[model samples]
Target: MLDLTKLAREMQGISQHLSQEAVASRQRLELAQQHLKKAYECQQEVMERQEKWRDRILFANATPLEPLNTRIDIPVPPKVHTVIATDGSQIAPNHHEIAYCYLLNIGRVVLHYGQNRYPLMDSLPEVFYRPEDLYMSRQWGIKTEEWMSYRRTASEATVLAELVREVGTGDGGLGTGRRKTGDLGSREENNNQSLIPHPQSPIPALAMVDGSLIYWFLEQLPVDARDRILPPILEAWSQMRAAQIPLMGYLSASRNVEGVNFLRLLACPHPAPDCVSYCPNQLEKVPCKVFEPLRDTALWTTQLTPGQRGPLWRSNNRILELYADQTIYFCHVHVGTEIARIEVPAWVAENTAMFDQALGLMLAQVQKGCGYPVAIAEAHNQAVVRGGDRTRFFCVVRETND
Candidate 1:
């Protein structure tokens, strides 16, 4: 329990500490703004040399296809378009439960606009009790939160892939589209119009997930666990790419600093940043530490209008080497309320029509939902498994078995 009386007494001291830090916070912001201005000035050289910095400087720098200061207005979305989204939730195996089992629930949503197409929203739940499902290796410990999260993401991607096939190409899903009722409702197929290279009125749609598309966390997992998680997500991305369906992962009010780290690469004082040799020995303040306090949102919100997006910045993480051809990219967009980070793959960023449509539809969805993507908002409503629900789920397992 919290001590409210003690907390009240400590409030003054907390305020004093915050007051002391205010000046320092402003100083860091000013320095970051100045460095961002310099970065924009030398933006061409930065992107030109950004590749070499990946090995030379050991920070998460980004490679951009446009100047950091460049902002594009969100395209006016087509009145007739569709947004398909998928999200997942899970209950890890608990020792306190009657049965040691985990549950994964995938929420699927499809909202078609302008035309008279009925929206579809559904949740699919699966339970796993097998040893193979709970353990990645014979030597591994209990399934951790990080482990289950990746599994949930894979499940979401797999569902999104199915939705894309049914919606984008009119081809039947890869047989993984199982709902509570085991049906993926019939989709209206338009074989005459292909999505690649911007089909004329051919499925103006975006497939979305709740978080980042990059599986960079694979770097932290053991080789065995990595193999289990990465391939499924990659396979899902591949399915979407082959269909040319523009996909995005909407991160609201993202505090990501990838752009700032790239700015650090440009601001490196040393002629060539030999990270291993220089970083370990540096006792003084790192030259680029000035920009560390700011996120991409802080820099772009001031420069962009509502429904405008910043330049596409390719992730420079070496873990992306495992990503093969599906290079991950991100950009900042102000969706009328706050600056958000939207992540996509290389193919989507390269195609102007697909890129604009995705962003435009994203902005439209956010506006329709009032500051959040509607499909994601609804999908979350479907995917979330509350504590009460978990209790009942385990209760059912206990009752049915006993």
Candidate 2:
């Protein structure tokens, strides 16, 4: 009853199927290997090209660029002296989420204050970037669309106009451009359109906007808006004489050693000896040495009190609490021979009371035996304090001016 020929045919059919599957698998494996090889080759080539570019940029001993002479030299006008310090904060719906940006512009005036901080002028012309305009599409990865209505509101413009009117007004009355005319004899007559100059006030209307948003808005503004807004600011600066009040700007940096090393590598051609053979596993054994005399130079060092000594020595927790106001304190050790220009923050400059109580105490120690005109720079320069809370304070001191 056993059919040997049929059984032989079935076994041969199974062997053929297995052979076909094995060939298919071999083809797939070869394709994967080829793709991996191509990727590795591309990555290696890119790395080599980047290294060459880096060497060319870093190694070249380029001379410092001369200051540009394109700055506009407007004549200084005679007017009343006033210091208008304007700070703008871009606040979102929720305080928990990160803000787009915050900017502070402080304009100082040496005018006599009769009643209050500078006599109560009718109004002050304050220019600020609208919060609604600060809805940055780049943050949310959205593109600005042409079809969308991209114009500022009438109310917003009115608010700015009112501010200007108040600031420009004096004992005589509100400055020109305060009223709307009616149609007379079926024709609208241009009557009170005149540039009435403020006699007592020569202090240019100081307007500090939040970040670079003002520049963007300027590009989109109508010719009329641009004319109205810019004049006051330019006049204010002209009156103040750009040299008098120190105009401050902010730049940020990384706190970690790796970040500092990368910056040094970018700035100069000299490769760090320890960084040449960097290994994550050998980090513990290798004693980390600060390279680049200019950047690596520690400006100030505060000795940890007996109570805070243990935590102060730890790597990340090196910062010690100095004052009761909760300002974080850390000892900075300056080792370089050359004097470094340090950048300070706005809060330290504006809030003399807090600076005296908290920062002044710490800086007092460093100022001892040091020459006068010693600059005490703040560490995180770009950070802007929006709210009244003094708890959220962070500071860092950089060795270089840039």
Candidate 3:
């Protein structure tokens, strides 16, 4: 029950504020584009450019994009593939309820595409009501929403990794075919393969995470929670890696500026040694300032065609500092009018065959959902806890306690 009259008036005021900001943002975007044009025209010492003004300039310090691959329009080859996607939703603890409790729900969908379309889905909800679960520590305070978010992410990673491990081991009742290298060739081929310790084999399946592989929420966790949560996630990741499961994190509507940052590197006016410790006065002359408000997608919108993917760029997040082994590289994919960012680990990113398959499957999934990954969309649909269900859940808890 909101006060409709007051709400309408407040919305009107908020809309006006947004309108003004939108106007300013457009002006800034235009200026940024102008600077980008000039910088591209004078693309000298591009690799040597430094991120000196990263702090002073908003959206600065972006690594200039180096296109490892050109715009590719590989059609989605007709293949029977297995795609598993997982998504999670959480309900923060409500103090008004009978017990201090929170709920985490995870939804997963496994789809087999080809002659017979079979979809297997599952939803799991874990309710936390114990005193130990309600609070982080007696001395610290109650478990904050951030703690709950970390739990949710860890749960997501666990589910994804476990699914990958199961699929990798040729279990989980999935309809994927595990093709051994020896099946295709003769004794000489067998001799060639048997000589190597670990031969390159195509993974039978792909595991799709609903978000980025890098856990940003880890940056905010308390020491205790941080220590407790990361192990399971990393172990699961290790299992997936050992099994050679190809995993991709898909962001349907990404607002990433990695491309923009890359453009900034290209725009650095001063050459190397001087640019690294560039002063404010010299920074003012840098060209990338023109594209401040524009995200990587904005630049790639016109640059890529439908189903075409842009180059891979390394992420610069501090969280990535520890994950160099699983270094993150993202590519911009043209999904109709929308641009999607697909992030993959170093194993998948560096492997040409795996990269192409991931990209193609992603494109096929996007087409299925019109603009987004259909597997993720379906998983979300299954995972979402409706408002009515939440109200009823709390009501049932209260009645049971009574």
lDDT of 2 by residue, 198-217 (tens): 45633333221121111224
Report the CA-based lDDT of candidate 1 relative to the real structure.
0.76
Q: What are the models' TM-scores? A: 0.88, 0.24, 0.76
**Candidate 1 per-residue lDDT over residues 149-232, each given as its tens digit:** 777777788778777877765432212333331211222222232222323456677898888877667777787777777777
Task: Return the candidate ranking by lDDT, descending.
Answer: 1, 3, 2
Which is the better candidate, 1 or 2, if ranked by lDDT?
1
Q: Compute the lDDT of residue 222 as modeled in candidate 1.
A: 81
- Using TM-score as the measure, the top candidate is 1
In model 1, the runs with Cα more than 4 Å from the true position are 1-9, 137-145, 169-201, 281-285
What TM-score does prediction 1 earn?
Answer: 0.88
lDDT of 1 at 193: 25
Which is better, 1 or 3, measured by lDDT?
A: 1
Q: Give one digit per residue, the lDDT tens place, for model 3 in 1-402.
A: 889999999999999999998888778666556655655555444444344444444432334344333577746644867788889887777888887788888776777665253365766677777766666543344245666667777776666665565555544423222322111111111111111121134434677888788777666656666666766666656666787667889986777776666556655464533444564454464554555557767767756888788766667676666664776777888888588888887778778777788788888888888878888988888888899879977988899889
Number of the predicted model whose lDDT against the real structure is largest: 1
